[model samples]
Target: MKIVKEALAGTLESSDLMVRVAPSPEGALDVVINSEVMRQFGAQIEKVVRETLERLSVTEGLIVIEDKGALDCAIRARVQTAILRAVENPVLEWSALS
Candidate 1:
């Protein structure tokens, strides 16, 4: 899905995370992540984000992840939510998300 505009999901509260997505002017995916557990889970968080984006066929966007010790599932959900919000006339295919 293409990011047509800026969108946000989730929150910065503990055990939760915030995802921000916007169109990339450079036509490339740019991801930034900040997490309370970065020392131990930073790579995992980045991997989850990248895999989620790939599954959604996201090619170009600026994604920012703010994590407060959220689980991988939460990260995926937040990213999916933000992507849906950022797309125009989004048509979600539930099976594809699996």
Candidate 2:
């Protein structure tokens, strides 16, 4: 699914994160991440984001992640929610999301 509009999900509080997504003018995936745990978990967080996007078949978009030490599951859920909202009426494939 392609992102057609700007969308956001999640929060900035401790143990949570915020996900922001938008259509990319560059026609490629652009991801930016800012996290409190960057010193220790940046790579893992990036890995999760990339994998999630790939699973959803999202190849082009701007994804901004603001992390506050959230777990992997929360990150995945937030990314999925932002993508779904950005698509603006997604036809979700339940199996792929798993």
Best by lDDT: 2
Off by over 4 Å in 2: none
Judged by lDDT against the true structure, how good is candidate 2? 0.96
Residue-level lDDT of model 2, residues 26-45, one tens digit each, is 89999999999998999999
Q: Clash number for every model? A: 0, 0
Tell me the whole-model lDDT of each prediction, alpha carbons only: 0.95, 0.96
RMSD of each: 0.7, 0.7
* TM-score per candidate: 0.97, 0.97
